[model samples]
Target: MGNLKLFIGVLVAIFIIIFLLLIFLVYKNSNMKKNISFLYTKNIELFKANNELTKDKADLNRQLNGNDDVFSELRLALELDSVVNSLNESGDGRKIGMDKKLEGKFVKSIPNGVPLNFKGITDNYGIRIHPISKVEKFHQGIDLRASVGTPLYATANGVVEYSGMTSSGYGYLVIISHNFGFETRYAHMQNKQVVRAGEFIKKGDLIGYSGNTGYSTGPHLHYEVRFLSRTLDPINFMKFNNIFYDERKVPWQALVKAIDDF
Candidate 1:
């Protein structure tokens, strides 16, 4: 009877040990499940944030490509003396009033180079706030930052249409008339311009020097390019081959034909 009691006690102890081991395994499994759930939730949140960043990047790129004028600041005036109404009441676009003699002289009279050696660009072409007026307006040209007396060059082979002081805010300016209805203007120039009105000039010819003249906060060259009196971004002409002429409503085909025929 004593031996039977000892066996029964040993069996009870074994059962108790098994029960405690099972409880420990169950508790460990519950903690592991909680950890896995937390990791999964954190991963989902990170994925959502990454997606939002990608979308923002795409939107910013679209804005840059679609509207270059969206970032324009500081106004530059367009006051060319010879500019006529490019578009008539009928909206007939791009009337090329080329001087036959001038066209014959220069077949390559297209503005395709930087007007001067500029350190950098302070303002780009488009709508922007006028520094003096503090009001929004259309800026017709780009402002190239350069020190006073920096030598300016003719961007194309053309005849000087105007070269003198102007009360219209571009203190001393020079406008060159080229073939294919294209024209280039250099503004805020020093009082002494080497070229005069009706003088023939070739591409890269020294025209004048930059200055702090007329509506300017500092010494800079305000450069402009136009086709039939319509303002075009000077940047496009600077990289002449890369100009998106179609989007800017210029007659690329006519220009090509004129050049070819000439």
Candidate 2:
């Protein structure tokens, strides 16, 4: 035989080079299993974009800590409405001095310095119109204006109960009688330094100057206040009375002579 057909054609070319090296190792293991399933679907979309960037950085740190607690409760309700409109340091701004701590607690019915002198009041009781019989009536009291003599005082600890001409026409009165039932008066005055009827007076003393005399209207300083017999409303009791015996100089109009009242 021709050398046994050339060793069976060199074992059929070594079994066709082992079937083309097993079809190039099964096409490089199907392109390395499609590059390991596209690197596990891009690492599950980069772990859902790093878990949605850690839930958008914890929703932007809870909206910046709820806007820093609503800007610290709107800066503590504008510093407690600037200490309740600084009641009466005679407004015009600056001097609202309030220690704060309010949600309602702001009581001070009366008694806290009490000196209430004058700062212009020129009439303000009620149903006005009568500047001098211009018509409508009922203006019980509160004229204040002050100029002639001006002293007046007393406002609190009292007893006088009658001082001069005021038989009702109050032309130079005084009254007083305080201690709960609280009577006050003061009227026109001007005949000068006079404070008699039972006398006890203490809250600032003086108790007499300021003239124009009852029922009229011009010089001014009527100021009345009754309370059990009723009358009340000396300009809403000096716009919420704390009177200020003297808090280092209050009087911007001190709260409200209706300095517009509250």
Candidate 3:
């Protein structure tokens, strides 16, 4: 009876050991499965990150290529180019200083030399009291005082539109139409030579001679510039034409100061 009881106790110990071993094996397998799942998720994320980086690099390469169309690379680039071109086309006041007009623009030119008085300016343009009449009135042009027989010059290249003694105040009026809406007139001339109706005259060419033929206080040349039959300030045009002066003639210190201040 004692031996049978001892054998039963040994059998119970073996069963307990077997149960513990099975539980340990099951827990180890569960941990391995969880680790595999985590690794799969990380691999997917890395693949996505690599794909995005490759796309970004390709875009950079396209932009760097010189052969690529300027409009390509990005939609925003096309918009920026359009805006810059528009600003340059507007011209505004800068175009006058730069002398760079927009494409297809027909730019006119300023006339050369002083008009009217041969030695100096006797009268200016705009409204002023008439020296002879002594009444407040608008002066249409400038008066240059000079002696008779002084050679008159064509202000610009143009064809003679009219040349004759005027019924009004002009003694010997010569009109040269430069087309492009620009016309120049020389009045109070002593003689009309080298110019006639329908004759083309070059710039600086002899057109007439100054005289006191017209109603005037003294001998003078009346020069007028008209655009489409409307008078303009001849002084302004002369100043604009003065842009091509010699910088060497200007004081170097003044030029340097202007640049520095600007």
Candidate 4:
């Protein structure tokens, strides 16, 4: 009887040890699975954050490109303005100081568009012998000679200030104030039609016809560009992308296409 009791006690002890070992293995496996799950969740969050960062980088690049394009256009406009201003004042021996106050204001006002309808240049801006007076004088504008009835158009959007003859050598002058310190004048017109003072004129809108007037010796149009009362050369302004004559319209498109291709 004593031996059987001892054997039964040993058997009970072995079974308890086995059961405890099984329970420990089960707990360890469950803990390992929980750790793996946490690692997977962490990895997923990191991936999502990385994707968002990539998208933000792309968007920032696009904005930077857009800003660059705007800056390029602004720089071109400023350069053209400076060249025209210098040419108009050249040979006069009078140095006109840079108009800092008018720079920002004028640049914001002139919109991009073609200014005139006639092609070819008869005269450039500088000191030249006056065709009519035969005296050395400063030419403040450029001459565009066309047919007597060729339509003269506004270069930019503005309100007309004067549309009549002036003794200052402008036969039939049309002055348009574009505000922001920029104004334009069309002189030596054969006739004035479809425009008047205080009338709102857009770029390419007909203001008059080109002709010999205002001390001109031949059939030509005198076009003057001004900024803050200072006369600027019309030639430099004509080099801008917005300025064009009838034949120049197609050439402008071709130039733009070439630039795009490049």
What is candidate 2's local distance difference test score? Answer: 0.62
Which is superior by TM-score, 1 or 3?
1
Q: Rank by TM-score, descending?
A: 1, 4, 3, 2
As for model 4, its CA RMSD to the true structure in angstroms is 20.3
| Clash numbers, per candidate | 0, 9, 4, 0
Which model, 3 or 4, shows the larger TM-score? 4
Q: Candidate 2 residues 1-262, lDDT tens each?
A: 9999999999999999989898989999999999999999999999999999999888767655555654444444444345544533545654434322221223222212223466777778778887876999887777767677767677567689778775566687777776545576777787665678897867666776787777666776777776556675665555544222212122222332222232
**Candidate 4 Cα deviation (angstroms), residue 225:** 0.4
> Which lDDT values do the candidates have, in the order given?
0.77, 0.62, 0.66, 0.70
Candidate 1, residue 119: lDDT = 96
Task: For residues 91-196, write the lDDT of model 1, one tens digit per residue.
Answer: 4654445433333333357787788889999989999999888999999999999999999988888999999999999989999999778888899999996999
lDDT of 4 by residue, 116-143 (tens): 5667788888899888788999998888
The TM-scores of all predictions, comma-separated, are 0.59, 0.23, 0.50, 0.51
Question: TM-score for model 4?
Answer: 0.51
Residues 1-262, candidate 3: write the lDDT tens digits: 8999899988998999999998988998898899899899999999998899899778767765543543242333333223322333434534332223311121123354554337877889888998777999988888888998888887767899989888678788999897456788888887555578999877777888898877777888888877678876666544433222211122323322333333
Query: RMSD of model 2, in Å?
Result: 22.5
Candidate 1: worst-modelled 10 consecutive residues by lDDT: 73-82
Of 1 and 2, the candidate ranking higher by lDDT = 1
